[model samples]
Target: MLLREIQDEILRLKQEKDIAILAHSYQSHEITEVADFVGDSYALAKKAMTLTQKTVILCGVRFMAETVKILSPEKTVYLANSSAGCPMAEQFNKTDIENLRAKHPDYTVVAYINTTAELKTVCDVCVTSSCAEQVIRSMPQDKIIFVPDINLGTYCKNLVPEKDFILLDGGCPIHASMTENDVFKVKKQYPSAVFLAHPECKAEVTKQADYTGSTTGIMEYAIKSDKKEFIIGTENSIVEHLKYKCPDKKFFPLSNNFICGDMAITSVFDILDCINGKGEEIKIDEDTRIAAKKCIDKMIEYGG
Candidate 1:
């Protein structure tokens, strides 16, 4: 079947089934075209909560679908690709965090939204890449525990040195693979381009970046900037999406190794299969759901 034909079927089925499709910004442009909403994981999950659809299809990672399920417990959430999971999210379980909490009883447990719902149940607050700095700063606690992604934790830690942030050695392998050398190589190639990076990258990579932000933040920065060229430091899909969005502006990826295999695994067929009820439906226990929501509620209270 043709791409258009498949997308048309998906479009029809979603409406008929009262399903809302949420795609992450890291998704392929083709998937984004068919999605009802596209943004970062936390943004898309928040968007899912506002949807009237009885069902939601998260065309991203498992953690993202879990987040949607937590926010809108009344609605059923399905992961388009069942195997799509974040390594970082799976790195630390509840027990590992609990052990750390035991050590630092005075510290606030701040879990990145990339974590599983189970992890959030034990967390004091949830933060997204887009609002990590602001949310972390808003906390009344002097000491904090930033889990799952040490790279992002380091970025936020450096921004607010006054706060004591306990870091873990887990992060997105794709983003973490990039280094200062890669940034220098890309900058040398695109001499006139501005360097934009994600905080998930290492300190060396972020240190050389002209701007560092979330997926949506990077897109908005590039769009608003008068510069005709940019080196994107996030997922490789952003370069393709940006090229299509702004033909006049040239977009170069920081490294060819920036590809995220997990995010790239979902196909249009996966969306079709999901809408057809063949996908993985994310389920959480009532106890887990209620407990998990506390951190998210705190995030909203803190203006996340």
Candidate 2:
């Protein structure tokens, strides 16, 4: 089938099935075009709770679908592709955090929202990239453990230097692959362009950036800034996304290596199959769901 035909079908079927489709910014432009909402994973999860639809189709990864299920336990959630899991989310198990907790009982466990359901259960609070600095600064504890993303932890650490943070050496390999050399090279290529870097990249990379932010942050910075050109430091898809949204603006990739193979796993065809009720159901037991939700609830309670 053609692109338009598939999109029309997705629109028709999702409405017919009482399903809300949520796409992440990292997803392809074609998928985002047919989605009911497109943003970051946690933002999409929060959006899922507000919709009247009973079913939600997550066009992201396993952990994202799990988050949708975590926030809206009553709603039925499906992952567009079952095998599309996040390497960063799965890097550390619950036991790893448990052991860390045992070692440092007084330290607050601050979890990145990209973590697994089980990992969140033992966490004191949760934070998105956009809110990590604020949330961490709000905490009363002097010591904390930020999990799964060393780059993000470092980003947060630099911003909130008053508190002590213990970071595990685990993060998105795709973003971690970027280096300060990439930024300098891209800057040389586009001397006047504003460089927007994601927090997932190394501190060296983000430090050289003109602006450091989340995926949504990067997009908004590019669109709202007066600068007519930008080198997006996140996923390569943001370039296409921003180009489509702002025709007058010029967007370029910081490097060709910024592409994420996992995010690209869910093609329009996968969404088509999902609309046909062929996707995997994200099932978290009630106990884990309830326990996992407390930290997310704390995040919302803390002004996320």
lDDT of 1 by residue, 1-304 (tens): 9999999999999999888999999899889999999998888878987888889999999999999998888998999999999998999999998999999899898999999989988899999988889988888888999988999999999999999989999998999899888988889988999999999999999999899999999999999999999999999999998999899999999987789999999999999998888999999998998998999889888878
Query: What is the lDDT, from 0 to 100, of the residue 5 in candidate 1?
Result: 97
Candidate 1, which ten residues in sequence have the lowest lDDT sum? 42-51
> What TM-score does candidate 2 get on C-alpha atoms?
0.98
lDDT of each: 0.92, 0.91
Clashing pairs in 2: none
Give the alpha carbon lDDT tens digit for every residue of 1-304 in model 2.
7889989989989888888999999999899999999999899998998999998999998889999999898998989989898999999998999999999998999899999999999998999999998888877787989998999999998898889999999999999999999999999999999999999999999988899999999988888899899999999999999999999999989999888889999988888787788888899999999999999888877777
Clashes of 2: 0
Q: How accurate is candidate 1 locally (lDDT)?
A: 0.92
Model 2 lDDT at residue 247? 100
Off by over 4 Å in 1: none
Q: For every model shown, what is its TM-score relative to the native structure? A: 0.98, 0.98
